[model samples]
Each structure stands twice: as C-alpha cells, then as structure tokens.
Target: TIPACNANYLPEGISEHCPIKVTFVEEGLNTNKLFQFCNVWAKHPLFIDKVQAAWVKLLMVLLKKELKVLNTQFFRNVVAEANDDRMALYLAQNKLQADPMNMTLQRRREGEILEVQKYIIYGRDVLTT
Candidate 1:
C-alpha cells in the first residue's frame, strides 16, 4: 500500500477523517513534473542527507510505477495472459518501439525472438510469433 504521507503533506489521519471526497490524480503521464518535484524534495534540508541516493531509489520507484500504469493502459483491451516470457517479449517490443536507439531493447527483442524461433524448432507449440 502506498503511504498517504508520500502522496501529500496531509496529516496522518486527515485523509480518513475528512468528509469531502478527494478526486484521484493521474500521476503516470506527468513523469517529468513528478521527477522535478522529487528532485526539489530531495534537495530540502530534511532530505538533504544522502539526497542523491534517495533520488536514485525514488527514481526507480517512480519509473516502475509509471511503467506499470502504462502497461495496464496499453494492454487493457488485449486479452493475452502476461506470463514471464510473454511479458518479457511485450516489454522488449515496447522499449524498441519507444526508443529504437536503445541497444538494450534491441538485444532483448532479439533474444526473445530467438527464443521463439527455438521453441518452434523444438516442436513446441508455445509460441505463435
């Protein structure tokens, strides 16, 4: 569960105590803004110690959160079950499409494609493409 404090400066119990409804804020699409906020927060006096380290960890979490959001949104209409191999291939394809210059994505897609080819060669009906 996400901590309420991490979300806003609201008091510990205030969110539960408040009678008014709070509209949900979509945070994934505005990654640049979120990173800027995290950068500023990391620079604050209270968070200054090991701010760089904190930023690294925060950035990882931020990235994961956004990626998950995007994956859900993008695959919402697709009925394919996301098993390990399928997820790896899907992520590799997405990365390749998003940034063709990324060598890692290229390598990953190549590896997945090779695996699919091997599976078909071995008489396994596990892969369609």
Candidate 2:
C-alpha cells in the first residue's frame, strides 16, 4: 500500500521564527514483499501522484547539488547540452562578465578573459544606422 501523507506546514513568507519538521517513514520490513506491493501501487492513480511528488522532491535535491558545483566540467556540459552553442556562449559570457561582482563565486582568469572577449565581440566596433 502507498503511504498516506499529512502536511501542516506553514505558507511561505509568513513567519521567520517558526521551525519546520520533515519526516519519512517506511511501514513494512520485508524487502521482497515490499517491492511486489509497491509494484501494484505504481498503477494506482493515488500512488501515481505520490510517486511523482517524490520524484519532484528528488529532482529538487539534485538541482540544488548541481547548482552548488560551479567549477565542475559536468555542469558546464549539462549547460551546453541544454542550450545551443551560441546561446551557451552568450550565457557564459554574461555570467563571466558579472562574476567579478558576485560575492558567491570567486572570479577566475578565464572569466575575465571571457568578459573582455564578449565586450570586444559585441561592443561599438561597427556602425549600423
């Protein structure tokens, strides 16, 4: 059976002093039996919502982790995969341009070069009036 959930969490932007509690519970202990039982619940409508909610929660956690790793090449690959080369380049240029001022990330030499290259590429070099 799919586990039922009850939530009484307060709405966002209401209180700054209130503490929140989160809990996860698994009812049965038999691993093989539980797998079979969960399989049946997968086709149920109520269980589908629960499963999707859990998946969304999992994705949120994964996204948070990905955002934390700024210098990872895998993240750069993922960003490139999500956008075309031109768009990705534009985004990288914009980020690199602003990175020196953002307190969250320490500026790098490559970032400064990107900023200068973007300026030279797009700045007032030609006339089109």
TM-score for predicted model 2 compared with the true structure: 0.26
Q: What digit string (tens of lDDT, one per residue) describes model 2 on residues 18-71? A: 334545565667556443454777777799788789999999999977764862
State the lDDT of candidate 1 residue by residue for 1-129, as single tens digits: 652332333211101232333456655576554434555665678776676788899999999788768757895522233244555666677677679899987788878766545544667444332
* Best TM-score among the predictions, by candidate number: 1
Candidate 1 local Cα displacement, residue 85, angstroms? 1.7
Per-model CA lDDT versus the true structure? 0.57, 0.48
Model 2 regions more than 4 Å off: 1-36, 71-129
Give the TM-scores of the predictions, in the order they appear: 0.32, 0.26
Count of clashing residue pairs in every prediction? 0, 0
